[model samples]
Target chain A: GAGVSQTPSNKVTEKGKYVELRCDPISGHTALYWYRQSLGQGPEFLIYFQGTGAADDSGLPNDRFFAVRPEGSVSTLKIQRTERGDSAVYLCASSDGQRETQYFGPGTRLLVL
Target chain B: AQSVTQLDSHVSVSEGTPVLLRCNYSSSYSPSLFWYVQHPNKGLQLLLKYTSAATLVKGINGFEAEFKKSETSFHLTKPSAHMSDAAEYFCVVSLRSNDYKLSFGAGTTVTVRA
Candidate 1:
């Protein structure tokens, strides 16, 4: 059984740039979530998707952050006009839609310089 | 609103000694609680969870946690510490009404000494 996988284990970009992080959930998972972790802090929720729809986006910090999961499996987290404050480890997790334990990915560490 | 707190920022135990990491949670209703461990540069791993099935839940690597409703606490414990157990442990809580959106604590860093 393959766990959640995130691409670009590490990404470095300049401020005001745009970046997209990808996530591949388990084969049959219908729920996906994104979170951000800053240094010396725990992960903060971002967005969540159920099937192909965004079930909850309230955790998203601002309009600049958007996420999509088309066809109910793969997801992408997009950040627009990234700021230095946006630098952190972006984590993706998936669950079986039964409100069970979430399986997390290795995460993509983004550095906005 | 549901939230969790790891009472200790860090905990250190010698090999073969007991280990305890305290965690407290607050929720308007019955909540699902979980403990996760994360090694450096690694992803979060589910240590154990309490889904109302059992008050005393056991997890991998000889870890266990007891859920105390009277105290609103779910503290992780292990009979003996292992060097490989050194990592950051996060206490998480999720509410059924909130689509199970998880709320994580600041985390407790455990250091197992030899």
Candidate 2:
């Protein structure tokens, strides 16, 4: 069985640019989550999806950060007008459903210069 | 508000010695507590979790944590330390409201010495 997989393990972009990170959750997992971790800090929640619709987007810092799971299996986290402060590791995780244990992916390290 | 706190930012122990990582949490409702480990250049892996069903919970790699409601703590412990146990550990909490969102603590970096 394969675990959650994330593409573009690392990304470097200039400020004001845009980037997209992808995540493929485990099969049959209906709940997906995204988080960000800064250097020397724990991960902070960003957004979550239950099936094709977003269940929570309160954690998104602003309009620049948006995520989608249109097909209910794969997800994409899009960031626009990236800032230096946006530099961090973006993590993705999935669970069977709400209240179930979530498994994590390797994450994509984003650097905005 | 719900929050988690890791009392120690770092813990060092000799191989074969006991290991302890302190964590405290505050939540209005019965929360689900979890311990996750992340080695260098890797993602997080669940060591163990306590969902209010049992006070004491056992996890992988010989790690364990006890949820103490009186003191609002869920500290991780291991009888023996292994070289591979050196990594960053995070304590997380989710309220009983059925929200899958987790609130994470700063994290504790464990170092193992031979």
| Candidate with the greatest lDDT versus the true structure | 2
> lDDT per residue, candidate 1, A7-107, as tens digits?
99999999999999999999998889999999888898898888999988999999999999888999999999999999999999999884767899999
- Candidate 2 matches the true fold with a TM-score of 0.98
Q: lDDT per residue, candidate 2, A10-110, as tens digits?
A: 99999999999999999999999999999989999999999999989999999999999999999999999999999999999999999888999999999
Q: Give me the runs in candidate 1 sitting further than 4 Å from their true place.
A: none
In model 2, what is the error at residue A21, expressed in angstroms? 0.5
Predicted candidate 2 versus true structure: per-residue lDDT over B7-104, tens digit per residue: 99999999999999999999998888999999987879999999868899999999999999999999999999999999999999998785698999
Best model per DockQ: 2
What TM-score would every model get versus the actual structure? 0.97, 0.98
Clashing residue pairs for model 2: none
Which candidate leads the pack in TM-score?
2
